[model samples]
Target: MGLVGAATGPSDGRRARVRIADVALHAITRRAARRIDHIIGDSTQARRATELLKELADLLL
Candidate 1:
C-alpha cells in the first residue's frame, strides 16, 4: 500500500521506494488467500482467513 505516489501523502509510511517484485508478491499472496477462502469457506462454521493463514505460517515456519 505504501508503494507508490508522493513520498508525503496519506498512504506514506515508507522512507524509500519498494521493489516491484515485493509489491507484486504481496498482491499475489493476498489474492491467493482470498481464493482459498472462496473455495473452502462456504460453510456456516468456516474459519477466518486471518486465522487460517497464521496457522499455516506457524506450522510451516
Candidate 2:
C-alpha cells in the first residue's frame, strides 16, 4: 500500500492543469505563425511555420 500510494501521488487536477497549459501554448504559437504568414508572404517561411505548427500539435497527443 505504501508503495502504491507513493507511486500515484500526483493528483488528476495537476495533470489537467498541464494539459491545459500545453493547449494554450499551441494556440498561441499557431496564432503567431498565422500573423507572420500574413506579413511575410514567403512560401518557404510559410512552409516552415506550418511544419512547426504540426510539430506543436503532435506534442499535444
Candidate 3:
C-alpha cells in the first residue's frame, strides 16, 4: 500500500478520533483544489471558472 493507504489502514492498537464529516470534507477540498488549479490555468475560461469556484466554496462551507 501507498502512504495514504497505509496511514488510513486498520487501527494499530491505538484509538484515533476522526470525524466522518471532517474526513469527507477533507476529500472534497482536495478534489476541488485540483479542479480549480486546472481551471485557473486557462485564461479564456476565467470568468466561468470563478463563478463555479464560488459556488463550490459556498457548498463546501
Cα-based lDDT at residue 28, candidate 2: 74
Model 1 TM: 0.26
TM-score of candidate 3 to 2 decimals: 0.37
Q: For residues 3-51, what per-residue lDDT tens digits would candidate 2 score against the true structure?
A: 1222222565334321335556677789877744456588888888789
Best by lDDT: 3
Q: Candidate 2 vs candidate 3: which has greater TM-score?
A: 2
Higher-lDDT candidate among 1 and 3?
A: 3
Instruction: Estimate candidate 2's alpha-carbon lDDT, on a 0 to 1 scale.
Output: 0.61
lDDT, candidates in the order shown: 0.63, 0.61, 0.64
Query: What digit string (tens of lDDT, one per residue) describes model 1 on residues 13-38?
Result: 65544344568779878977764555
lDDT of 3 by residue, 1-60 (tens): 221322333666464444446566788779877745554777768878778989999999
RMSD of each: 8.5, 9.9, 8.5
Alpha-carbon runs more than 4 Å astray in model 2: 1-37
lDDT at 35, model 1: 47
